[model samples]
Target: MTERKEINVLNENVARIEQEQPIGISVLGPGAADWEFWLTSAGFKLANQEDADVILWVDPEAKDFPAIAKDPRCIVVGNSKTNALCQQKKITYVKDVNDGEGIQRQLEEFGRKTRETLENPTLAKSRSLTVPPALSPQRPEKKHGIRLQRGLIKRHLPPDAPLEDPKGELREEFREESGPLSRRKDIIAALPSLGEDERRLKQYIQEKSEGEYRVLEVAESYADLIRAAEKGFFEVILVHRELPGLERNLVENLKLLREKAPGTRIILIERQSDDFSAMYKGHLDVIDLEWQVIPELPGHLVSLLKGQYERQPENHVVFKWEDERKPVTSLPSVRTSVLSPALIAYHSAGGGVGKSTGATQMGFVFAEMGYKTLIIELDTEKPSLLRAVGAAEDCPGLAAWNHSDFISERTAIEAIRRTSRQVHGLYVLPVGPISPKKVVLPFHLEGLNGGEEENVDPCQQAAVFYSAALKEFQIVIVDTNNSCVDPPVFMALKMAKRVFYVMEATKVFLDSAEAHIEQAYDLGIQLSNYRIILNKCTANDLLSLRTITQTLEIPVSLQVPLDVEGYRLAAHQGKPYKPKTKKGISPWGEFCQNVLQDLEVPITTSQAKKPSLRNWLLGWKKKS
Candidate 1:
């Protein structure tokens, strides 16, 4: 089957008239002087009525004007008689002319109309001819005619006759017959300076291709490069590493260029020995001057145009470095209190993955170590923290705060209820009486007012509350909903200094965890600030740690062993479980200690004490 070609004539005309060339406009009568000045300043060409695509009529009473005014392409400017005539004729009219803003508005309207006319021209009102047989205006008629004749000859050739590869032979013939001036490729070189190397490359390409490759030099300024690229005038863009104003913002500038000219090939010129060369090797072609000199550059450029280069590799890479040296020093050490509180948010891939449980347990650990910790139940959907801590279910908390207009520091502190006496120094903020079903409603539904309420984002209320809680507490732990796409969950992740992404060790949970982490990365969260915690892990599954780490590209900081019986007993009692230990630490206690150590929190002297043997023996007996 022969290859098919699709052409969009209207789009082609619009692009040519609006972008490549100035739009032609005609103005009539005495009051059109201002209109003519504005049109010329806005990139419109002043032309006579015979050649103009848009004609503006400003005169109230001009002879033989009815026929011209009836044309769909005519615009009637403000004039008493003209307005009445246009109204009667049911034609478009503008009523204001003296106001500067009005003139600008009319200019914009005219531009829009010009584009629309070019994009969807009516056969009866069209001022230009339809698209020609050849798609490109610059394509020679002789060349198109020759190609047509060649196609006809091939169709008539006998099926049994031996046939050469016509496409390959025709391409070779075109290359040999056409000189550099006839088939030159347009290239834009964005370099810092027009130095010897740049001039050499340009001269080499022109000489080697016999003038088939033309390089247009552009200043290294990003604004100039971007404007040129947006015009879509060049087939290739050559960017140097030292381009002016791009030293610190190269990646962002290149991203803009890529978006503007997606079809153009971008090549980065850098020294082969440069360390940064490897960083940009995969995103775009890297031309190393050490390996490929000026003479070979032209052929390489052609190869890229012909799609002969290797496919681009993954563009993102993480580099890791390790040092084995240990330092020896003898000096008095001073311990300084942390200046800012640590904000930790617990998020899971799905519900029922123990996000709240982990957050509450961690809060208790911090409190036991002498840190004034606050656990905010941000999961309005379920609001399980109150139930978990055995606090009053109807206590005023996040919901009440959301409904109130202003909250004083004293009042905000009072909203937090102390946990059971067993866990001292720990506070709990319940989600209040709001039903989980209606938690998704907009904050405006509550009708709360005053104190930055006008600037508050409904999705970011959790962040606002977290900020207020930080004023009186040293550590803030937020238990968020499972869905990463949830607004509250997203805000929690964005504001937290550290995040604990909790999940089970099963295949289903692992898949969900991978997707969740990927989505977080897409939202611009740094991977270093997040730690993956594999909950309910077993000893037998330790071998899968490597696979999980490789798949998610994040290290698992802690793995809590499965303890169904302990969790069940705690849930039944409506409180977090605290294991009793004697000679050695219990599995649950060991997990909590490891997490605290990873967070760099110093354990208190009270927590270092070992339990009595009598208690250990009693615990063993109960287990038996």
Candidate 2:
């Protein structure tokens, strides 16, 4: 019989066996113990061969073959060589003796055969299933176009088949033989809600484009359509107007798809009654053809989008939504209008001026006001931000960012989002487990810089980091090293919307402040953006506030008095310095509030506080 007829008979026999419950089975010969365990688990009860419905004769090629083959209930299972006796006797054979599935199928067949024999006893005595001559012990057995070795199947490749797939020629041959659209990269994704129309549209597009573009059937929802466009890199997307998300707002989702995949064209499919051309401003033509005329639509669309692709296989960038990162010969100037995240940089001309403390305190204040805030510690030499924030040092921060392949914006966002730990609504990312001498922020090393060491600039990487950080957070406060030559400080000063010049009221700090400001101005930081904070102020200081302002040429923003013991106490406790007092707010909080005012951020808290216990306990509550 042909393989197809055998498969059909096997399926019919299995279906017949499913109607009955577990049939009694008996085991004999070698491997009987293991077979008994498997048979019992398969819901077959053990019994003697005389009383059992079926006999599983394992290793029937042995001397016990004749004894088991005489029984009509026996199913011979093994790589048996019983001459021509078993075939002449008409016995059921299982070639792979150890295969559980094959054994189960043979058992089910026996069950059906026994049922049929009981229903018509004359049919069993008159005829028996004849084993094909090809399955005889003298002839080699073949199964499903593959040569059967002892009990296993082995495929033999053509003699001229290539051993290696160099240049992907072999893979291309396989793809070409598999289907017309198998190797096509330019996809045209269609939503599943198109129903029967989806098949017709796919056929039309394939007929018109001549298999240059493949139709990818995606999920029925608009959200999944966006994901398909993002990963599929399609040439065009067919979005149904009746999609679930479009009911909320059609224009918003179209704009989102445009942003997510600027390279792909979105063609909205709707009926003539549902017109959104005026709303979309004919940004792209909407497909409103009748059902009969849909075949002609693909021909015209194929011509218009023949070679125009927003993204290409060889011309892809790290950030598809943004332009490619070009090589820089000079320092990048800061953006004045669209400074994302309202970045504030805390810098000082020298150490021990409470720069980190000021940055932490300000971040805490912004976080308290319910703005998602992150404090990026750019001081790679001595990263004290983690210690001050009380988070563990063993974190994937700058070290992970440096070692990881942040080839796209999503990777950078996910790295920062997954690695950073939150503290009282404030997120703190450490420098790393082990502080490096310099942190390299190579976003896409090979693609952006062509794998050249000279192109791996720390300043450029800082810009990439900041660009991702802007999307993740609303308020970003950077704490930098004292040196102007440091990549973190220079980039922070240049990119920050507001820069706080933290220095003590001492003469040593005051004198160096002017030189640092001049160097920063030469580096593209405007002098107007500087907000000087006089830290560690003393009552008997020699330099007055007016003289200090004259020397620095920028007016002092705030004066924080000497608090060595208080700061030490806060540091020991591993928290920001927010003094608990009966008064409304502390001086540190007031300085943060002033900084917010400079940034033009509203000073409103997240939610109103509950009434105090004193108001309910006594009669001190205000009457409404």
Which residue pairs in candidate 1 have backbone atoms (N, alpha carbon, C) closer than 3 angstroms, thus clashing?
180-211, 180-212
Clash totals for all candidate models:
2, 0
lDDT of 2 by residue, 395-445 (tens): 556656652434445566657755565543467776665454555433323
Task: For each candidate, give its TM-score against the true structure.
Answer: 0.39, 0.43
Best-performing candidate as measured by TM-score: 2
lDDT of each: 0.53, 0.57
Over 4 Å off in model 2, which ranges? 1-340, 403-408, 434-450, 580-585, 608-624
Model 1 Cα shift for residue 49 (angstroms): 99
Error in Å for residue 260 of model 1: 68
Worst 10 residues of 1 by lDDT: 143-152
